[model samples]
Target: MVKSNDSMKKNNILSKVLIGAAVIVGMIIFTIYQYNTAKAWSNRIYPGVKIENQDLSGKTKGEAKSIIEKKYKVGIIKKKLNIKTDARNYTLDFSKINPKYDIDGAINQAFNYGKDRNLLKKYQLIKLSSTKKFDLKLVYDDKPVNEFIDSIEKEVNKAPVDATLNISQGNIKVVPEKKGETLQKDKLKKELSSKINGEIDHDIDIKAPMQAVNAKITGDKISSINYKIGEFSTEYGSISSPERENNIVLATKSINGKILMPGDIFSFNDIVGERTAERGYEAAPIIVGDKVDSGLGGGICQVSSTLYNAVIRANIKSVERTHHSLPSHYVKLGMDATVDYGNLDYKFKNTLKYPIYIEGDASGGVVLFNVYSNNSLAGTVTELSSNVYQTVEPNIKYQDDATLPEGKTEVEKPFSTGYKVKVTKTTTQDGKLISRETITDDYYEPVEGIIKRGIKKPETTPVIPPAVPAATPPTPSAQPSTTPSAPKN
Candidate 1:
């Protein structure tokens, strides 16, 4: 029984040894197979490795990069992206953006697919790559793309246009406003990126995104001015100088066709700008420091005065107004509004609910201003009047003149009477008085009469006694009888 048991044990041990040797032989064969496979693919991509779905199997790093360049980089350079807009279509070439692929990175990844793993893991991955397919990442610079999009934006964007009014003679025309359009840059960029990164085998078409822009001043807002609310006219016939008349005409033209919305303040200085020779303003008569002198933009004050009266009649509020140092010849004593650039400005605000328009005309010795507004103010009437409260007599001034003969006199400047006056504005509707308000109390300075009297003495003529005959010797003896008889004293 013991020998039989030992025999069974010996046979079992021999069976175990044979099984262990077979296992060792199988491991050695598997290691040799793995090593051979890894060595074969040491410089080549795996069978299932791809870049953007383009198979790079069995290709070396240089060969893989060449394949990707021919398939993607070359194709990208030849491909174009069509951008559609409302106005037109723009085509952008991929070459402009200098498209590039990460050829090195993709090739390295494919080549190193199974290199970092153990024999079993490497075999499993090498086998799995056939069906699992490893894909490489794509990288490119987006700066050029952004620059192209910016150019597109500049070409597509438009500024909105506001409505305006044009008045000629008595006719009025309304120019309609126009809406604008802007490109949607962010949305367009995303769309382009998606398409550019997805494929490059064919030309692309992308619709540029856009948004609408609204105009600020619509036609309806400017059409509210349909009636003449107030008007005033001043005669420039007394101003004989052509330069002064030219200045008046230029200034009136500057103020013509001006529109003022509710609560808008109109600045005479801002509208007329600085009066200079470059602006076509001639030297004319202007009031400077209590003296009338020739200066640039001299006669524009008449236009300002005329417009001021019209504004007052329209019931508009004056924000800034100044009176001349001396009474103006065209307007009443207290009704003039004088403006000097950078120093004095005549400003008024539109107080009505609707917009107002100013129409000015200076022609044929007449300077006129017409204020137009809503038709609701048609029946309203405004009357302006000035009352003189005190009159100041001018003093006479004498000056010596050496050029004139003695007792001669010449008037340098004529005397002008000064007055303190009160200006009042009266408003009435349908012959019924609505309101009466005192506008201003102004005082005009008196101008002294300058008279030049002659201080030079007159030239005297020399008076000569009749030529006395040369004393001759007494006629002989007649003179010789000297010491005759002396008359009794």
Candidate 2:
């Protein structure tokens, strides 16, 4: 019995020793595996990693980057981005923008997976990755992509038009506003870039991206210029000179039916353009240097002068003006505004709050100009007065004439007087004076006629002291005279 009991005890001790040895071996193997795994993951992507379903397990970052780039990277020079607008397909070349996938970033993300987690979490990640691979997210520069989308906007965009006011066929009218369209650039770029970078490769059907832009000046804004504000007229002989009348007609046509917005400048020269022979300007009589001369645009000054008076009455400010060298018969002395193509011009500004229009006409022996606006100065009466402040008399001179007979006198030109005049403008409303101002101080030159008289013979002849007659060939001789005349100083 004692021997059997000792045998059972020895058997039990052997079993315990074997169990401890097995536990120690298991621990050593586990330590070696953890060390190997940590070392392997230091420079390589985690197991079961993928980029767009392409596995990158057990590969270094560089190798994974190469693999992904080779599979997904496309030649930008050959790629094209398709844009569609109302059934029109536009192929935009990708070379200019230089689009490419960000392979390095995707690979780096895959390499870092399961590395920053705790031991247990790392195990869980690995376990999860076994069933479903971890996808490396893709990224790219959006600047070039966005700019490409912007380039398409020019071809597809249409700008809106504002309503306008003008005269048509001698009647005031309002032009309606026009609608416009634009491409949906911002929204299109987002969707297009996503499809291009997505893992699934396929052609995308892009619907036409369009939007509406409203006009700033609506129908209500067109009503501001509906009424006449102020006007004046001057008379002209229509039948005397056909070309002069034609010029007046042409200039009036150029100025008539025009709109001047608030604070806008009306340039007669700029609007009428150069008055050349090619522009249908005929050679007619015009004033230059105090004389009537033939020039390209003759009687257009009559139109301008008439418009000037109308502008003054309308209370519009003149920007630039120069009077004729001599007083004009068409308009008042201080009221005429003449324009020389390159040297001089006439301009006025629309000082009213609302826009104004010009109505000009020359017909039936009369030339007329009228300024119209919504803010009518109908009850305002405009009156003009002129006062001769200084008068200059003519000077007379005489000259000897060799061609005319002796003691015969002839007049070359008639005498003329010069005068300086002051022009004043007075405005009255409701029988009460509103404003009184001096408009202009003008001076006219005087010209005197020239007279020439002829000299027939000498007044007296000098005689020599009684001397013997010189011997000469035989001829009838007279007695010598001894009277000598005094010389005039």
Which one is best on TM-score? Answer: 1
Per residue, candidate 1 scores C-alpha lDDT tens digits across 1-89 of 35798899999999999999899998899789988887777777777777777887788888888887778766767888789987889
Q: For model 2, how does the per-residue alpha-carbon lDDT over 138-241 read when each residue is reduced to its tens digit?
A: 35556776665676787778899866656656477788888889988768877785666555354445665799999866656546666555566766674348
The C-alpha local distance difference test score for the whole of candidate 1 amounts to: 0.85
Off by over 4 Å in 1: 1-32, 46-55, 67-83, 90-125, 130-178, 183-206, 219-225, 233-305, 320-330, 333-347, 360-368, 386-422, 441-489
Candidate 2: clashing pairs of residues: 229-373, 229-376, 413-449
TM-score of 1: 0.63
> lDDT of all predictions, in order shown?
0.85, 0.74
List TM-scores for all candidates, in order.
Answer: 0.63, 0.52
